[model samples]
Target: MSDLVARTGRLQQRYEAGCRLVAGCIPFRYRSSDETDVNSEKVVEVLMINSTSGPGLLFPKGGWENDETVEEAAVREAIEEAGVKGDLMDFIGYYHFKSKTHQDEFSPEGLCRAAMFALFVKEELDSWPEQARL
Candidate 1:
């Protein structure tokens, strides 16, 4: 079994202005168009996971815990949800959204603010915490 484990619960979750603070990453990789060509065109591919709630794909994300920096949380989410490890490149931006399921005392309206980043995927694990869910 892998030593990796996904964090759970909202015990350390951060909230601000009735919005649950979240962090996530857009994992991507460069693929060579032709292996034979010395200067082959590189194709960019973004990684996405199957959403547990419905019929859609989503980037890895979760609550931004108080114990970790937003960048740490984003990287953690990628490993937990996508079973991939990578270098977090750039800060994409913050996005706001609402989710009834995420409603809690801190976020009565389920309002969420997600800080997203670009991650250059470096490793893909054959066994990860959430691999069974994939």
Candidate 2:
């Protein structure tokens, strides 16, 4: 079987010479309601993927590569990790996080700045990269 894990060998870890940048999205879908139009203003439930290596839920995310825009990286991460595709609705916010396992030559502290977006889920795939393991 093919590996479902998202590959990050080509991704860019640094925003510049010293800054670490990451991109991610919060996938969400509107719950079924009496309204005929699915796009109608309804209650929304965020899609949270369970982590195999961690206890808490997580949104799909990864390094923002130098070859792609931030939006593209965010969408790609969502498909690879969450097995979902959607329209990015809006920019949620930026978060700074520290990782113990990510320390490298670029950043000794493993400090990272993440760009987060709100994704309006349009389709949920039956199979995706790492879908089985995730």
Regions more than 4 Å wrong, model 2: 1-5, 34-41
| Highest lDDT scorer | 1
lDDT of 1 at 95: 94
Could you tally the backbone clashes for each prediction? 0, 1
lDDT of 1 by residue, 1-134 (tens): 55898888889999998999999999999988997886999999999999777788989999999899999999999998998998999999999988747788899899999999999999998878887786
Name the lDDT value of residue 99 in candidate 2: 62
Quote each prediction's TM-score: 0.95, 0.82
Tens digits of lDDT, candidate 2, 98-121: 764677778678788889999999
Error of 2 at 49 (Å): 1.3
lDDT of 1 at 126: 82
Model 2: how far residue 87 lies from native, Å: 0.5
Residue 53 in candidate 2, Cα distance off native in Å: 3.7
